[model samples]
Target: MTASQDIISLSNPVLLEKVDKLRDLNIGQHVPLPQLVVVGDQSSGKSSLLESLTGIPFPQDQSLCTRYATQITSRRHNKDSVDVRIIPGPRALEEHRKHVEGFHRQVPSNLEFRKQFVDILKTANERMGIRADVSSGSGTVFSEDVLKIEICGPHEDYLTIIDVPGIFRTTTQGTTKNDIVMVKNLVKRYIKDRRTIILAVLPSNVDIATQEILELAEEFDKSGERTLGVLTKPDLVLEPSAQAAVCDLVQGKKRPLNLGYYLVRNRGPNSGLEGHSELDKIFRKHPWADLPRDRVGIVALKEQLKSLLVAITQREFPALLREIVSQIAECRREFNSLGSPRQDEREQRSFLCQIAGAFQERARAALTADYGADSVFDQDELRLITHVVNITDVFNADFHENAHSLNFEKLGRSEPSEEVEMLSDYDGVRKASSIISDLRTLIKKANVGVLWSKEFVELSEIVTLGNTPMPMPRDNFSEWINGIYLKSRGLDLGTFNANFIATAFAEQSRKWSEITKIYMRRIIVTIHRFIAAALRSVCSEEQVRTQVWEAILQHLVKCYKKAMDQVDVLVEVEHRKKPYTLNRQFAEARSKARGYRATEQLYPKARKDTKQFGETQYVVNLDDVAKVAEGKNNMEQLQEDIHDILHAYYSLAANRFIDNVFQLAVDYCLLHGPSSPLKVFTQDWVINLKAEQLERMVGETKATKKRRSGLAKKIADLENALKILVS
Candidate 1:
């Protein structure tokens, strides 16, 4: 058996399933077998070639014998017969009669009826058995009809050949009447299921038009289907040498016709024959005649038909079957990959809602306990209370100008708007609302929060309190403090503090400097934790771990860069500041600045510079702490450690998940294997053949034990091979 046959046998079950589905769905009407379409200029020997390849007789008279696309298939009757089925394009049958009359009348060619011209010529061939003389009128007299011919051979295998309308005609028309469109549609239909192979017949007389035909052939071959070129009318050229030269020039070794070309003859006894003596004569006359002859094949018209029957029955049809089965499998995989969109969306939403609920619960608890309900007459009231208490007296005094402006602004605006201004005093509350709104929207859209919630909180806190202290009215200290107390809001301060403390602890653990990092990390961690928890709680523990680790790594990269930037800025400031001078008043100011600079430089250095005592006091430390700090002051081990910790944690927590993903990737690759066409064909052939054998061997009688035994062995061997392939 051939490689393709082998694959078909192994994948017989799937192939059968696909065929059943096609039959059940009645999809065969839409997807036909792979068609080998032949097209060329009028009198270009297209029909003659089709007859030669399909072993079917095509009328050779000057009259257009085939009007529309005729599909030919091998049929089994008491005697072998070729069933010729005609599939006319829209309005093709009606127009065919008119086209024939028009061609005979020798009427002037109308541009509007250009397509109809080819159909008329085809109809004349089909019914009247007349050929239009090219010298009589323009090519537009021909009609637009895709001629289909199915040649049923004595054997089970037969190829469907589509003889397209000729391009060249005496008509004034500049284009091949509907030929391109028909060819394109043929390609689309064939490619849907079968691997379409184009057999382009190029006349030995080379021209710009022939070159264009070769170009189109190349474009059509990109569907991963094979395209074979045939140099026709070898007898027309007198010199064999000249003929070969023309063939090489027309069919170059480069793109489109890279598969090489076959020399053919379409007149006399050798007419419709490929690789015949006439063809060899042309090749021998060419410079590249030294090329292998096996790459080229030849036969007379009658012999060509016989050869085509063998080719289709033995090779092409089986290969086409393999291609169809493979395409079906591919379609199945694509559908599987897409999954159920609604289910996916619903799952995502559920996850987001869960995280959002958690966030809302935490935030509400913190607010109610920290700021009393009585204090929070509205959303802004809670902010106003927090702003009054968190701001430092000194900073509040500095903002006295804005504070007084607030009273006037408050009177001008609504109570809610005024409270919003006061809450703005504490940058945290001012920014929180915007940040929360954004978080809510993202959560709703993605059905998940940012994985790093701790980071965001840290960022908010730093931005709010980095340069200012809590601001409150000192004149009414008790009342001011009590107004913002938990008791007023019917909330417990301990509960609020507990939630705040947990967030604060997480921030310290992460050792993040920038409030942005804090804010970002908080959202990221929250998302990560939620996903991890949900996966663990609802799905597999391994999946939870895998997703959490992936999320953590993605967020870590973001946080690491932010931390590095902050460190760079700090380092730059320390490097640019000058040392202190205590002598003058300006010197005193410079002295404090220098001291602050020294502290900044020393702190980083001490943190980064590690010490080891070998000989104790007797040995001077080779690495100077101060110098090391100055050189590498930007080092942030704490940040790096946090990343390492997260990585290690996830690795330990989700190792199974990682392993599963890895295994999945490996399995996918094994199933697909190398994507080279030759390899795919071989693999598919093996699979198909095995499947076919199995199906045949499934049921056996005692009388057939001998045959069944051999088949059973073959099936065992195939199963073993399949196991090895999958493994």
Candidate 2:
């Protein structure tokens, strides 16, 4: 080794050792692993070139023998020896998200020579469980695994170069289309590192344009800035002019790369330890006389590579550290996000507590529209959570003003009294006509009057039905009623039995009561239906991407599901809640429609008062109104009393129903249950999350622990390297 080379090597011991420590920890696979990489098309004599560089013989067979990426770290030493080690790929790291898997196994002892190198690979693949799972029996002939060979010799450069499996245009024996893709990807992973300088080898026999390695090198080092084009098998170009062209390419006759091409003649892989020196002899001196000695041999190539590696590494180390630190921040975020795997009941409980607590707080904030004024949620999310009150208001307006609905009582014909006239009680029948006359007079004076329509032949069939409550008149009833005066014929007034009139009214009254109750029950159902929907919107997944949601649900589904299932218990309570109060206007409207409760005896006080609500006056002459009930006792006014009491009661019931639904069913049962908001999961759900529900991954997986160890070691090594470089 030259004194200058030794000085360069010794000067940066920390940088080299730090890289070694990273390799030792197998941290490269997780990030862009930095190193010099060799890439070339199939059988481009890359093996021969490697042999010449390190003097290790490669098999000359046409078979794809160099299957994995082999890294050769050659340094000058007093005693010559080789040590091989296996470095695992990213597959073994659980945090590694890619689907690809790779192999890692080592040669147990010092490699004696080149023959054992190939043997070690074959043995490693079999030992590491590499074989074809497909029925074709093609076997696992190639892989992305790496084999590290550390060689020391007196003439070797203090350098590390990775030789990836050669890229092939077509598949040969026992290889599939997958083999081609795998090889390209394997080669790409190495050369894509910004720190690595690409060495693209091409055979002199093949036109340089035909080689794909040049394109691949350009993929990473686009301006040919870090790529050094190396030509191998220069002797294979038989024509003198062809040889001259090759020499011309080496001398920059064709468009020269920023890092120009070099030439080497690899006679054979089995060329002995003195192989590179033998190539340097140049037996046919005149054939190659035009070429520069520095651009034509392994000795010059090795020195050139050593100088390049030293200069580039020293120059690029700071940028490389910055990249590592940036990547470390990213990985640490991922590493922290994965958290820990929950392997035991205690760990699972703790893990669930952290997630559930976070979710519950967010959910509470979402439901109450209490996301702080500074909080920034999406428009859709804000609308959903904050504007639930809009739904409540709409629901309120719908049920309140619709008095003609089935939920309210009003006058309408159910069955004709002509049918009741068929009964043989003639005296009872004659009075029924007077009974109709009597009620008709009373309805006209009442403010809420829905009189029988013109279609009715008789007034007996008048029924007050659901939701169609009578409309209250705009004008005061007292003014119209006082205009009426009755003419007295002075005929003999007869006593009459009025039981039939009361019986008919009593029956219709019962029907109205039943219908109104049924309608209130339906209101309960409507309220809860919307509440259920609100529950789903509150508990559902949001836009954190597929992976975050999957991970959250994968761990929290049981807790969420358990809470949802128990929601019905709260809803049932809301459904059964009955209302007890009435709005003043609602009660007055109902009372005016059935005002027979203000009996004839109270007539003197009902004069000319524009009083409000239930106290409003409706005057009628006592003499004429009394005559409508001529000679009748128990059955005469009984139906009127029932109507007045029941209609008022229905208003109270309807108002009570509305309040209960919004306050209890929606607000309490869904948004704010007895203990907490509907968005909260029950304690039982978190406490009993199935042991199997979680992946036992509270940073708990073996792979994650291994990765953590690797990362910590990597950070430490990098910090050490930075310290030394700055120092």
Candidate 3:
């Protein structure tokens, strides 16, 4: 059998199955056809172009002649029958709500007035009228509304010609704001499908070099649909030179896309035969004239009525149907893939549980190490360290909060009051002094000589107040305290107290500075060794060794500087000549040291504290870590849960993919073959009923030629069969 016959035969079983499946699916039945959506600026000849192409005298002069998106379909009827039915535009309820509200506001006193006014507005908007109004007590008030028209003609068996509202007008006086929104909604709804082709009309007067057309083209191009540009009102150009100039302006400019443009004219009374002929000659000479002429035919308003009938009823529509079917199938595949929903929650749940368990174990180990075996600390040294950690945590949290909140504060605002600063200073002094006293006791217990006599106490007070360095210890008591403090602080110790310690120590330890240096160096080396060992244990030795060494070196340098600051602060306090200068420096130092010690101690501990973190890494085979009870209830439950989740996801994806394939196949068959249910439904009911009703009621008939042609073919086939039987 031939390709056509093969297609028809294949469609029989397929079409039947599709019909049954569609009923089972309960999807809306749609008659597929190639859609040519005409769009342009208001009064930019969108309606005129439709009239020209279809030969239908659509109310071109009506102020928004195409208000709603009208869809036109071509159908074949019996001999001596030609039908034209205007399918009503889809009711845009959301758009109409604004109009209804506007009417209510305009006529607040009369409920009936608002109702009547809105009704007229809706009618006028849909029919593409200039203005719609209802008479009130005062006078007739006009409201803006636009009309949208869809002209169905007999050009092709399944081709649809849609006339859209004009865009890029200087004024939308006749079109309501909602009308514009409606047009955009229509474009989004139709163009997103990729099955529809957009025929954008541009006025010849607009500068092609402008950003307007470029942006418009970009919007359509990005949608992944085929968009064609038609330059309308060529007849108005009058001069051949002007037309050529316009063409060159469009063609020469560098655009986002290599958009094709066509010159078109809508036949009008002003556009006589001579004018049309001249316009035609000018269009033919243009660089883009080689496009198929039949697809780009031009006709006058009166002639449009006849041409449209022929165009809508012709075999060209069947070819369009094939193209639309193919496009929709492609779109279906893409949409199905992207729109697939999340599947098999049970499987996801099981995996989530496994991840949770791993994190829980890690969390417990961390909490125990950081908080210690007992929840409380009785040792003076441990209590001091814990207090420092608490203070550091508070400072870190507040600093982060202030950093973020400072941006929101009003500009040119005064700083916080001195009372607040004094209170903050008091709190800092109390915490630091308490921690220092505890440290003194711990040092004595550890066999470090008592370094806190009356003189040392006075020096400690001065250092605390002014961040000054104290005199070098006679014994190595200072070295012992520094070591204990640095050890407790961990990695963060380097960041928090580097500056304070550096300046204080440099001045205070001038006499035995070299000995102080030796003690500080030992502490730095010890911290680095600990950090490196910890890093090696957790991460790969090969990958992290270099990074660990670099980090340690940086921390040591930072801590050395802070230790020196402590010495400097103490020396400055001792050498000051005037009490005023000493007091000022002391106040400044106290304020500066508010969060330093706490910050230093907390920084290192924070790095090691991972109790709060859950599931930093995932590892396979739980059996490797612990024995698995194969037949245990808990293990069985976990295994079953994981299995269910995996199966669920797989099943969902498989079902969805299969359903998408089947649906696409059904749509393809319906759009292509003659015996498809969609075709039969459209031909038997939608087309036939509308045509018969229009003839019986409206007493209007446009063209009967297509119906006559179908009859002639049928009769010829029957006669040939009879002759063959006789022979």
Candidate 4:
């Protein structure tokens, strides 16, 4: 008879109840629920050992591949019954899930379960065919799906043992060199979970070194902390020397384990089932069975496991309470993160409204700088109206400062020669031509250039021979006005014209259009960012969020393209075709340059032989002469006059161009073109959407929905368990 026959009730019923709650809820996925994980080399009699321990019928044909993880959980109960479930692992195949789900759907209720289970395993494998190569690095891959069997019957000890697929050393027909690594990884994953206690099953018939399970156990649970060594098929250890070695291992004489080894006799893989009487006859006759009760049989191993589990539970219960609370909190956070589903049509419409309202409010706040006190950046909080006024001030300052900073001018453009030929040597004209070339260089550059007539250069380079000369030289007038262009705008009346300035202005206008394009891009990018933020807060599903983003982006692209095309059309059709002509100041400068043919005719001078006072010198200032010459304008004064007018016109027009560019960006790109990205987002795209189209666009996948619901239910289950544990 088995050892449980004498036991009246479970010694750790509360612990068993906790384990049941964890298993039923599938809480180990979240918080690593504690258990025993069984692993061993192939043909190590792992299946028989599990059956004897739990008294549950499992797939036992040696020819059939175990291809998946099997979890066996059994407890003593009033009646005999078995429950079977399939849990798809993380690496489980999609076709495998379909096969399993299909089976669950079509399975008959009144059928004999044990026989049906064998057929179910067979059907699942046939549907989920094996693939040897999964990746370049991995040689052979298989399913990690778990086949869980929960059993309850009279005289069964409460236990949960996971039977992993057997480890292999060599390549076979359906397995490869990679299969050896894959199987080991599968075993390690189960046993590596901290809450799991390792059960390293081995065959006494083989060398202990070949049992890879023992090596892995020592590697993961060094010092045998949570490891139990179980030796199966002791009857097969027929040689006296092999028997002595197995006996020494059980008694802890050699290679001592903290939780020592135990020996059991069972058929490893025969076609028919063996009754306990046949095993009892062999055990009664065998010399190894006489060693010790605690180290020899399945009954002793069951008792040992119960005592060990009880002690481990006592030590781990406090941590388990903490784990339950932690897991509950984690699940709650994840559930809230998933948010309430938008299954209702009204809910979808309301989400669009929220996105629309947030967009407009944020845009208005940005324009008005009314972000209330919680604005993150000081820059974001700055008033846009104030920013515009400040930028205009900067524009005005740049206009005046750069106009004064002309790099090319009349200063020293000519030098004095010692002879009368100096006046006609064309030195002044050569100097004037060089000055014009410099002006051309500064045409589109920020540092502009201005010029004056050669007559002006000749007049400025002169000097009075002596006071005996009755009238002062015209050179005096030029000397007085050397730096006049610094304070006042001046031009070479004899050389360039207003049309030249207009062509220069056109170059600047073209550059301005490129700059404005950059501005347009910046505005569109800012709006794109706002649209994405709006989408994230409104759309729950990734597919829907992506749809909204693409719609808005494509809309903006079309709008901006049209605006840019209009600018090019405007430039070609109207702006450049009109003939650039001279204005009033340009015409006046032309007349002045022709009249003042000689430098002597430019400024006021003393009378030929003045006797008003003996040798008293008096020269009229050209500034007054300039005031006088202003009304009596000549060629020299034309240079300064034209310069003044050009600056005035260009400044006004440049500022106006800037204003036009900015207004277009605000109106067409920001507020209205193609209704703007933000406005477009709020539009009823769903209005014309077909039922199937809407489903495809916004509907969640079955797997995603299942995952979300599963997490929520797990959270609730954990919370309830946490309350019980804590109390």
Per-residue alpha-carbon lDDT of candidate 4 for residues 587-690, written as tens digits (9 for 90 to 100): 45334333332223332342334566665343554544444434544545645444433434444444444555455544554555545544565536555545
| Global lDDT of each candidate | 0.38, 0.54, 0.37, 0.57
Query: For each candidate, C-alpha RMSD in Å?
Result: 25.3, 14.5, 32.1, 14.9
TM-score of 1: 0.33
Lowest summed lDDT window (length 10), candidate 1: 404-413
lDDT of 3 by residue, 465-524 (tens): 222343323433234334534454445412333343333333332333333232223222
Candidate 4 regions exceeding 4 Å error are 1-11, 56-70, 79-154, 170-186, 236-240, 266-293, 314-361, 370-550, 553-727
For 173-284, candidate 1 gives per-residue lDDT tens digits of 3334464455445434433333344566777665425444555555555642356667666656767666557545445643334445666654444444443355456556
How close to the true structure is residue 210 of candidate 1, measured as C-alpha lDDT? 45
- CA shift at 203, candidate 3, in angstroms? 2.0
User: Clash pairs of candidate 4?
Assistant: 451-492, 490-640, 491-639, 622-626
The better-scoring model by lDDT among 1 and 3 is 1
Arrange candidates by TM-score, highest first: which order? 2, 4, 1, 3
Identify the runs in model 2 with alpha carbons over 4 angstroms from their true place. Answer: 1-10, 23-28, 59-64, 76-81, 92-139, 152-156, 168-181, 209-212, 215-222, 235-238, 266-278, 335-340, 343-369, 373-400, 404-680, 688-727
